[model samples]
Target: MSGLFSSKRLRWFAAAIVILNGVFPALWILFTSLKTENELTQKPITYWPHEPTIGNFISAFQDQPLLTFLTNSLIVAGLSTLLSLFISALAAYAIARLRLRFRGLILTAIIGVSMFPLVTLMVPLFEIMRSLGLLNSYWALVLPYTVLNLPICTLMMVSFFQDIPRDIENAAMLDGCTRISALWRIVLPLAAPGVATAAILAFVNSWDEFLLALSMNSAVAYRTLPVGIQLYQGEFAFPWPIISAALVVAIVPIVVLIVIFQEKVVSGLTSGGLKG
Candidate 1:
C-alpha cells in the first residue's frame, strides 16, 4: 500500500512539472508581447503590461512587409515539405522493400550523407544556384531545402516501412497489384503517421532556416520572416516590444501545427525509433 501510494504521488508530481514548464514560457511571451515600448524599457521591469496595447504588433506589420515575408516563408516551407516527403517516401520504399544486391550499401550512403554538416555544402550549392540563375528566386531556397532534408526523411520512412510485415506486400502481389500500387495503396496508408512526422519536421526546418535564406535572398522583396526580423535590430538600438511581437508572430504557425498533429508526431517518433 505504501509503494502504490508513493507511485501515485510521483506521477502527479511529474505531471504538474510538465504542465508548468510548458505553460510558463508561453505565458511569459504573451505577457511581454502586450507591453508598450516605454513599459518594456522602464527600470525594475514590469511583470505585467500597465497599458497593454496592440500598437507594437501594428508597428511591426507596418514597418516592414510582414505579410509578404510570411507568404514567402509559407511558400518555401510548404513546397519543401511536400517535395521532400514525396521523394523520401519513394526512396525509402525502394530501400526497405527491394531485394537488391546493393540495398545495404545504398542505405548506408543515405545515412552517411545526413551526418555531414550542412555548412560544408554552402559554397558548392551557391555556385550551382548562381550558375542556374536561381540565386534570387524561390527555387533556390526550395531546392536546397528539399535536398537537405531528404536523407533524414528517407531514413525515417525506411524505419517505418521496416515495421510493416512483408506478408502484406506478398498478399498484395498475389492479388495482381504492382509494386507501385502496393506501395501507394497498402504501405502508404499504414505509414501515414511516419509521413506526417517527416512533413512536419521538414516544414519546421525550412520555416526556421536562416543561414541559407539570408545568403541567397538578396532582395528585400524576397526576404523571409527570419531575415526580415533581424533588420529590426541595429548595432546601437533595437525595439524590444516590436521585436517581441514579431517573434510571437513567427512562433504562432509552429505552435498551431504541433497542437493539431500532437498525436501523430508522438506515435511516429516512438514507433520509428523504438519498435523498428
Candidate 2:
C-alpha cells in the first residue's frame, strides 16, 4: 500500500511540474504586460503588477499598425493552412490507400524535404517569389508557409487515414461514390481529429513564422504580426510592457484555437501514436 501511494504521489508531482513548465512562462508574460514601465525596471522585480493598466495595449496599437499586421497574419496563416491541408489530404490519402510503388521512398523524400534548413531555402525562395512578382503579396508568405507545413501534415494524415478500415471506404464506393467523393464524404469525416490537429499545427507555424514574413513581405502593407512586433523596439529603447502586451495579444488566436479544438488535438495526437 505504501509503495502504491508513493508511486501515485510521484506521478502527480511529475504532472504538476510538466503543467507548470508549460503554463508559467505565459502567465509571467501576462503579468509583465499589466505592469507599469517603472514597476518593470524597479529593484527585486515584482512577480505581479503593482498597478495594472491597459495603457501598454493601447500604445501597442497606436505605435504601430498592429491591427493591419494582425489582418495580414490572419490572411497569410489562414490561406497557408487551407492550402497545406488540401494538398496534404490528397497526398496522404493516396499514399495511405493506393498501392503506388516506392510509397515508403516517397514519404522519406517528403520528410527529407522538410528537413532542409529554412535558412538555406530563403535565398532561392526570395528569387523565385521576386521573379514571379509574388514578393510583398500574400502569396509570398502563403505559398512558402504551405510548402513548409505539407510534410508533417501529410505524414500525420497518412497515419490517421491508414488506421481507418478500408471496408468503410469500399462500401461507399460500391454505393456509387467515386474515390474522391468517398474521401470527401466518408474517410475525412472519420478522421476529423487528424484534420483538426494538422490545421492547428499549420496555422501556428504560419502565424509565428518571422523570417519569411520579414524577408518576402517587407512592404508595410503586408507585414505579419511577428514582424510588426519588432517595430516596437527602437535603437535606444525597449518597452517591455508594451512588447509583452503585443505578445499576449498575438497569442490570443492560437490559444483560442487550441482551446476550441483541444479534444480533437489530444485524441489525434494519441491515436496517431498508436498507429503502426
Candidate 3:
C-alpha cells in the first residue's frame, strides 16, 4: 500500500480510473442522446455516433411541454424548501434554546416519522388529497414534500442551532432585543450554514420525488420533471434519444445549483454534524 501511494504514475492511474467510473455514465448518456435511433440499436454498437445531431434536444422540448414541467418542479421545490426552512427554524429554536420538556423525545419522534416508508403512506395520502380537492394542484405536491422533509430538516437545524453559543443570543437580549428579534437578527445569521444544508436537502428531495408526484397529479399539465421525463414511452415504442436528452435537461438545474452553492452546502453539512 505504501509503495502504491509513493508511485506518482500509479496514483495518477488510480485517480483516472475513479474519475472514469464516475463520468463515463454521463458521457454515455450524452453520446446516446446525440445518436439517431438506428445508431442507438445498431448490431455492433458504435462508441461515437456516425451521425451526431441536436434533433433529440429539440424534440425533447417540442414533443413535450418540458418548459411547463420545469416550471412546476421549480415552484413546488422552491416553495417547499422555503416553508420547510421557516417552520424548522422556529421549531429548532424552541427545542434547542427554550429547552422544551421532552426535547429529546420530540426530536426522536420527528426522526422516526421521517423514516416512514414513502410507499406505505401513499394510499392514505392519495385519498386525503382527493378528499381535500388538491389532487391536481401544486399544493398536493408541496404540502407532502414539505411535511415529509420537515422532520429531517428540523433535526439538522437543531444540530446547527445547538452549535451556536447561547451567550450570543443572551447578549442580544441584554441589548434590548426581544427573543423574536434576536432570532431574526443574531442566531439565524449564525445558523446560515445549517439553513443552507436543510434547504438543499429539502429542495432536492422535493425536486426528485417521483411516487408522490406520480400519484398526486395524473394530469400531464401538472407533471413535475421526474414523472414528465418518464412520459417518453409510447404504446408501440420508446424513444431513447429524446428521453435521454430530456433527462439531461431535467438535471441541469440541480447540477447548476450544486455547483453554485458547493461551499455553503459543505459548510452546512459539517456544521450540522454535531449534537448539543
Name the top lDDT candidate. 2
Higher-lDDT candidate among 2 and 3? 2
lDDT per residue as tens, model 3, 70-104? 99999999999988988888898899888578978
User: TM-score for all predictions?
Assistant: 0.90, 0.96, 0.90
Best by TM-score: 2
- Least lDDT summed over 10 consecutive residues: which range in candidate 1? 24-33
Question: Cα RMSD (Å) per model?
Answer: 2.5, 1.4, 2.9
Error of 3 at 35 (Å): 2.0
In candidate 2, stretches whose alpha carbon ends up further than 4 angstroms from where it belongs are 1-10
Q: What overall lDDT goes with each candidate model?
A: 0.90, 0.95, 0.89
lDDT of 2 by residue, 26-136 (tens): 999899999999999999989988799999999999999999999999999999999999999999999999999999899999989989999999999999999999999
Evaluate candidate 2 by giving its C-alpha RMSD to the native, one decimal: 1.4
Error of 1 at 107 (Å): 2.6
Please report, as a residue range, the 10-residue window in candidate 2 with the lowest summed lDDT: 267-276
Off by over 4 Å in 1: 1-25
Residue 72 of candidate 3: its Cα lDDT? 97
lDDT (Cα, 0-100) at 203 in candidate 3 = 94
Q: What CA RMSD would candidate 1 show?
A: 2.5
CA lDDT for candidate 3: 0.89
